[model samples]
Target: MLIFGAAVARDRAWDVAVELAERVGAPVWAAPASERAPFPEDHPLYVGGLPFATGPLAERLRGHDLAVIIGAPVFRYYPYVAGPYLPDGLRLLHITDDPAEAARAPVGDSLVSSAGVAMQMLVGALRRDRREPEALTPQEHRMAPHPPTDATAADAVMSARQLFATLRSACEADTVLVEESPSNLADLHAEWPITEPDSFYTFASGGLGWNLPASVGIALAESDSGRRRAVVAIIGDGSFQYSVQSIWTAAQHGLDILFVVPRNGEYAILKAFAELEDTPGVPGLDIPGIDFVALATAYGCHGVRASTPAEVAAEVAAARDRSGPTLLEVAINAAVPSLL
Candidate 1:
């Protein structure tokens, strides 16, 4: 199967690939890097990135009888090749969140839902034919703490581990979490697993500001269906600012939602990338001293700010007890890497 798309799609597609592989008992092969399928090098099922030409990969696919493409366009780029990438007479199915992509890809079968939902549906359909895997052993479940020696004085306040641990404690079985912390994704994936069908997590698409809006959407969906699930959005300060205006919509609709902002003074991810490049700090990356609490208050929602892990836990607990919309900002150390 060729799974490709935005990073959000990549994250979701991984889950989909896991389910599909288990169902069909087929080894999934991915193409090389293009705009669509940017396969994570660290992942186990990754074949390799697609090259400018597909002749080599197409030859490899000649043995497979069917190809299922998910969350990517039919063909990202031809690179001057005027031939079908699929072997002659091979069956193809495509699935995507975007109907436009499904229409453009011309799939034999198409499903319209987020990648996570699609995976859930596929897993449900395959459940009769498959047995559940064993749960993680207690030893495997043990996670290490963020090493204190690795932290600088300025980095001691709120580490990613602290944030994720606090959230994990507070999360209910039915909670839906929409995450847009690009730099914190690895840490989160390492710490959290989807143990229940109702526990949903989604990240940004190609768009920068999806967390807040997606939380609102999920909240609305839950409320309209009379479900008691909480919709929580975890956003980084840099990404939150992109769609800060969405808070008003949540407040207006009276959606029961919790918004948590991890505030560092700069675009910490980009700053780290700059350090890797051995370049000096880029100007305008630092956004000093913005009042997120007051911004939430202005939008007619409850707001609170916490500078320590304890305070963060307290504020989140208080927000969860409320019936309406609320925003809580946790001030974090910006200098440390967001993921281990």
Candidate 2:
């Protein structure tokens, strides 16, 4: 199996990674928490992102005898899950541009080189192997979409799955997605298929307060380059507060960026961590009474609220035709996900 990281796309080697995967007849898994789409998610060889912990990642790659990891750390983990990094007898070769990334890995043989150069060299040196590409039959390889929820109730809040499915259907194929909603990561990844290069971006280190401002910059660049692809940012309510002032910049400059805030009235990601760590009854996890639409209006951007799928579709369509940035806050169910 082959694995790719953010640097593979960052260094403009997406095509090379795809070519190399095709040459080796291996399926590709984007490294855990990868910020960019190194390989097209629509490709047959693409198996989606890996798990974020040691044991789960190893178990996910169980049948693979040798794994070639490119342009990423050997592994990036969270919650301090204790287990072996790789399964017994499974060999790994880590290739990356940063020496620090190569040095700190707990397992695997490391090589430091430019991601594009190393992959190009490998493409020339390695012949296409005869091994039949293995089938990815289990749920770990790709997350199946959740069944669509009924959005008919007068005051019912949509689940994250429903919201993502609605957005996926409404969004354009070439739309650039800037995502920072950690709690909704699984649903969003399963629903939204990123088919084009440079169309999806997130913070590799999972930092807060970066994506909102970064979306502004991306929209500005899009306008200047004459490629006016719609830029939509999916930010959690907790993360939206970290750099809420940045929306003012987007408004002042008239950048056409759409900020979709999933208002669940809590820090869902932190709650998930607390559960994983067995530290329950944590105080101050629920955050209530924050008016995101009002805050957007205060920042001089158009603001609205959507509670159902139809409303969400209408609001997104209207935002696209608007001249400036808009913020659409959607009410979503507050189900905390198991992050393993």
Candidate 3:
């Protein structure tokens, strides 16, 4: 099995990774909390992302006897979930550029080198006599289903899953997706397909306030390079407020970026953490009545509110023709996702 992490994409080693995987016909998993996706989500060998805790990860890797992890540590974990780091009879080979990361890992033998160079060398060294793994079974490329329109008034709002499905349908295949909506991330990952290298980004630290500015910089880089891939940042309302001022820079520079805000009117991520930590009754978690449209307009961006599925799709499609930055605040149903 092959496991990928951020540095693989950072080093632009995805082509070599694809070659290696195809040569070996290995099953691949995106490491948990990976900031950059190193492999195409549509690849047949691709399974999905791994869980971010020890017990859950071990259980996921139970059937695999050998794991080859590239461009990351043996594993990056959170919440101190207690369990064995690796299942019995499983061995890991870790390849990373950072020697410190290799040394710090509790499991796995390490190889320190540039990701691209190392993968190329591995591809050259593999014996020609090795048999390719059996072909992957065909699977349908279906996204999450849309919400039923005939629901009760209480269930009238668009769900996070529906919002992501709309985004997946509206966004271009080459669009660069920068994500920071923590609570709804699982839904986005489930719905959106990262089909190309360098097409997705996120904060590995899992902190707030970086995504907005970082997206502006990404748009700037695209301008400088003249590659001009569409930059789309999906941010939560609460986190958007942290560095909302960055939109001004995008506006001033005339960067063509689309900022999609899923407004649930609360710090939904914090609420999820509160539940996980068994700490309820958390005060100041609800942040309602923030006019994101006015705030975006004040920053000199084209602002619009999308409350329905059709409006969301139309706004996203309309954003492609915008000359400067556009902020589409989508009012979605409130739901705290499980952290694990």
Candidate 4:
């Protein structure tokens, strides 16, 4: 079994990891922040990204006899859990360039080296006596679409779950996604599984507002390369406000960025956390009465709003066809979504 990290794609050796997975009949994955599966998501052996929690992740890694983790720290966890990193009875191998990460892995044969080089060496060593590899089922596949039948466009709010599921089918396969919308992230993952390397990126830090600026950076890089790729950023309304100034730079350069702001009108994730911990309601949570279209205009970019699934599809399609930066403000429900 092989687990990849964001650094593998950064090194442009994600293909090496994919080849190793195919050779060993193991599924491929990256860290949550690195869900951009180095291999094609449609491949039979391509599993999705691992969860952030140690318990759920340990459960997933339990059955494998040997696990090969490369490029990433043995683990990058959020919300903090204290326990054995890996499940018992699972012998593991960790390969990474960061010596500090190698020294800190709780249980693994740590090898400090380049991930690409290590994988190349392993591939060369395994091909001496070729044999048919065993079969493994891919655990990552799309669920049936569940559109919101009861919702109405007149309400000026769409369901986030419905929005993500519909967005996947609407967007191009090769489109690159920059995600900052934490509310419906699990639904987003289920809807748009990463099929290619560097196709999907999210801020590794648990910070808000980075995705918007980061999207502008990626868009400029692609523009400079003379590529016509659809680079879209999905931001929570709260996060979108964090680095909204960056949009001015994107507009100044005429980068063709499609920024989608899921305006849920509240810090929905924090609201959920308050519920989980049985705390009192928090103040300064709701984000109300900010005209995103006006904000976009002020930044010298085109802007539109969508409250229905059909409108979302139309706006996204139109934005993709354009050659300059556009912001599509999606008025979504304020319902708190569960963390995956």
TM-score of each: 0.62, 0.93, 0.91, 0.87
Question: What's model 1's lDDT at 61?
Answer: 55
| Candidate with better lDDT, 1 vs 2 | 2
Instruction: List candidate 3 stretches off by more than 4 Å.
Output: 129-155
Error of 2 at 139 (Å): 4.9
Clashes of each: 7, 0, 0, 1
Instruction: In model 2, state the lDDT of residue 292.
Output: 93
Q: Between which residue pairs do clashes occur in model 1?
A: 4-37, 5-36, 31-50, 32-49, 32-50, 33-49, 33-50
* Preferred candidate (TM-score higher): 2 or 3: 2
**lDDT, candidate 3, residue 223?**
91
- What lDDT does candidate 3 reach at residue 265? 94
Best-fitting candidate, measured by TM-score? 2
Candidate 1 vs candidate 3: the lDDT winner is 3
Cα lDDT tens digits, model 1, 61-165, are 576577766565555442333445667767777666777877765335676667656666777777557543332222111111111213322545776657767
Best by the lDDT measure? 2
Model 2 agreement with the true structure over 1-340: per-residue lDDT tens digits: 9998888888888888888888887988888878787888878788777877887888888987999999888787766777788998899999999999988988889999988899999998987664456665423324221112223223588888788889989988889999988877777777787778899888876688899899999999999999999999999998998899999999999999999999889998888789889997799989999999999999999999998999999999999889999999998888777776
Q: On residues 80-153, what C-alpha lDDT tens digit does candidate 4 reach at each position?
A: 43456788888889888999989998778999988788889999888654344456554432211111223323
Q: Give the RMSD in angstroms, all C-alphas superposed, for model 2.
A: 2.7
Regions of model 1 farther than 4 Å from truth = 1-20, 23-69, 73-156, 197-204, 273-279, 336-340
TM-score of predicted structure 2: 0.93
